[model samples]
Target: MNYTLDFGPVVAGLPDLLRGCAGTLFLAVVGMAIALVIGVVGVVLRESPVRPLRWAVIAFVELIRNTPFLVQIYFVFFALPLIGIRLAPTPTAIIALGLNGGAYAIEIIRGGVQSIHKGQVEAGFALGLHKRDVFRFVVLRPALRAVYPSLTGQFVMLTLTTSIASAIAAYELTSVAKLIENESFRSFEVYGTITVLYFLMSWLMMRAFGLVSRRYFSYPVR
Candidate 1:
């Protein structure tokens, strides 16, 4: 009952924390971009005619989805150096985040792609669209529209996962918070403030996604 809260350290570290927020956003955005690319490409290859290519994508998805992300980040940061593939902490964190997010993205987007009706693809072809055009316009667009909410929700989770990158000394909010807490011994205040910041960041991300959904995925008005 004698404990009192002090926010002096948290207030002093606000500038650094704001910078860390930027770093977190940077990592999340880049990682999500990479994951989206991987999801799309993996889905294509997952449905490829070549059995080996399909198997490879399946193995990747299962391996990542089944493993711990901490281990994955450790492998990327520590093990890769053994193969002469060293990367800086930031790059390592980005790669780890991308791969982790991408595995789940592959499954999420595959579900979306599968939700498209075969008849719509056939109609696109009947309209003289090329195979690629049919897939892009008739299949991919509508499928993405259908799954946009799920995909964005996954991306938000991926954003939160950036906290794990701190284990590797990546320059993000959690890493910065750790430093502040170590120096100030104000774990409660530091963590509590950063917790609010994280919630706000997630809320902001959802709002941004809402704007995108309204703009790009909304059904056409009559």
Candidate 2:
């Protein structure tokens, strides 16, 4: 069994795949930003006095977490069009990724918020900080610092989930790899290269998050 391996096609398609990787990164970054916003707002609302708001957030989290992400993206891309709410594939992918990641983020952020002691909240008031400022600075910031690792892990999962965007013909790394495989008829070579690209991108993303955490969450020791 002498099967000669050829990487010429894979090398030729590297530029296209790299461009797709850029698309994947953009989607992930935008999605994560949206997720963070949703997570923070959900946590705030969940802790509010309004029962309806808390229930709404809980429903959203449960709905996303309980369903398949592929189904969610398909609904966003296809079903929305029937309701006269059509979005382009890329935006659809971003929205789906955001909503999916945000659900998990809500839970992660909630854990962090719950970790804050009542004494700390009282201390913020004692320092004459406005309630809003206290929530933002004392509660939110420290809570985020506590949950940064988990949050970044969720973001990485969102990045990987962008692969599902290929189902909607969204421009991303996996979509590009599929096209290359079809054209080159070298499925092994194309997918092998794509696998490496994904691993490298994930590693880089984690490293970037680590740097950001160190810069923003570093605390002075007594």
Per lDDT, the best of the predicted structures is 1
Q: Which regions of candidate 1 deviate over 4 angstroms?
A: none
- The 0-to-1 C-alpha lDDT of every candidate, in the order given, reads 0.95, 0.94
Off by over 4 Å in 2: none
Count of clashes, each model: 0, 0
How do the predictions measure up, each by TM-score? 0.99, 0.97
Shift in Å, residue 162, candidate 2: 0.6
The sequence of per-residue lDDT tens digits that candidate 2 reaches over residues 1-222 is 766788998898889999999999999999999999999999999888999999999999999999999999999999998999999999999999999999999999999999999899999999999999999998999999999999999999899999999999999999999998888898888888889999999999999999998788978669
Q: For candidate 1, write residues 124-204 as lDDT tens digits.
A: 899999999988899888888988999999999999999999999999999999999999999999999999999999999
The TM-score of predicted model 2 comes to 0.97
For model 2 the local lDDT of residue 101 reads 90
